[model samples]
Target: MTELQRKLYRQAFALALITIFYNIAEGMISTYMGFQDETIALFGFGIDSVIETISGIGVAHMILRIQQNPNTPRDAFEIKALKITGFSFYILTAGLVVTSVYNLYSGQKPETTFWGLVIASISIFTMWALIWAKMRVGRALDSKPIIADAGCTRVCLYMSVILLISSLTYEITGLPYIDAVGALALAWFALKEGRECFEKAKSISVCGCSDGCH
Candidate 1:
């Protein structure tokens, strides 16, 4: 790799690490609060964070491999990772959809969502910052996986917004179903992302391209 490519790879690596750490922390807190309050939306959001962390680790591993051996043919690994990420998103979507429907049917309401509000609010800003940085680096390198990772972060931003709005609305109006609505929204977004990721993977696989497939 050229020095410039190396620099971008290093930046990508750092961003991936940052994503992993942030998501882990966010996932733990959100999951705990979600279960404690019986909030489907928050719990689903936490699960998404965990999946994103896995995706980030895959991206980080790819970046490291490229940095170490610039000529490595990354087609196989990239395809596999993309497929896994895409499949995970589909799983998340299914879970959220099923849970949301159940909650709606049972009229389940979250007992307290103050923590959900705070967590989602914090995640919004953090995700925006990470998205900006990831996009900048991904665009600089014309790296498809990195760019796709940024798109994943963008989905997280949307999820945070949904969580914040739903939590606040429920808190204000004491409407239990709104939480399920938010979860359904998350499911839709996840489905879209999953399809896109799968398509990207398919494209790369068909073209037999490496890391610079873009």
Candidate 2:
């Protein structure tokens, strides 16, 4: 492997590790905070993080596999992995949207947890850093795996921004619906990214496209 590829692989692995840690933290925080606030969005955010963590790990695994089998046919595995990653976001977003709308109609107030907000903010900031690093590595290496990993981190950033907006807005406005609105916005973001990723994946010509193509 080239030096650049090696660097990207290392970076991808690190990002995956971070993703797992962040998701675990999110789950704990959300669980603690959700019960206090009676807000499903808070809990949902943690669930979303878990998904992101899994996606990140999956991307990392694919990167390792591709590196080991640099000659492996990239036809179905690559395309399918990308599609699965993209679909994950779609499902997450759709679920959040439904939950947000339901919460709005049900008229439930979000519980205020200053600690939760603080931890979430910190977590989001860290994710942003990781995303920035991933993007740089992805560009330098021209590695699709790295790029896909970056995309996962980017989504985490988006999720964080939405949660930050919703939680802070709630604090200021005393409007619980704002949080739900923020979640809906996040859901839309997930859908958009998912569709785009799927399209990109579909457009790529895989190895073994035809007989002896690889």
Residues 88-124 of candidate 2 have per-residue lDDT tens digits of 8788787888888888998867767454467568878
Clashing pairs in 1: none
What is the Å distance of residue 81 in model 2 from its true position?
4.9
In candidate 1, which residue ranges exceed 4 Å CA deviation? 69-71, 212-214
All candidates: TM-score? 0.90, 0.78
Best by lDDT: 1
Q: What is the lDDT of residue 172 in candidate 1?
A: 94
lDDT of 1 by residue, 1-214 (tens): 6889888889899999999999999989899899999998899889888878777877888888778876665556666777887899999999999988998999988997888899999999999999999999989988776897788888889889999999999899998899899889988988887787788778876776666663
Model 1: how far residue 21 lies from native, Å: 1.4
Candidate 2 global lDDT: 0.69
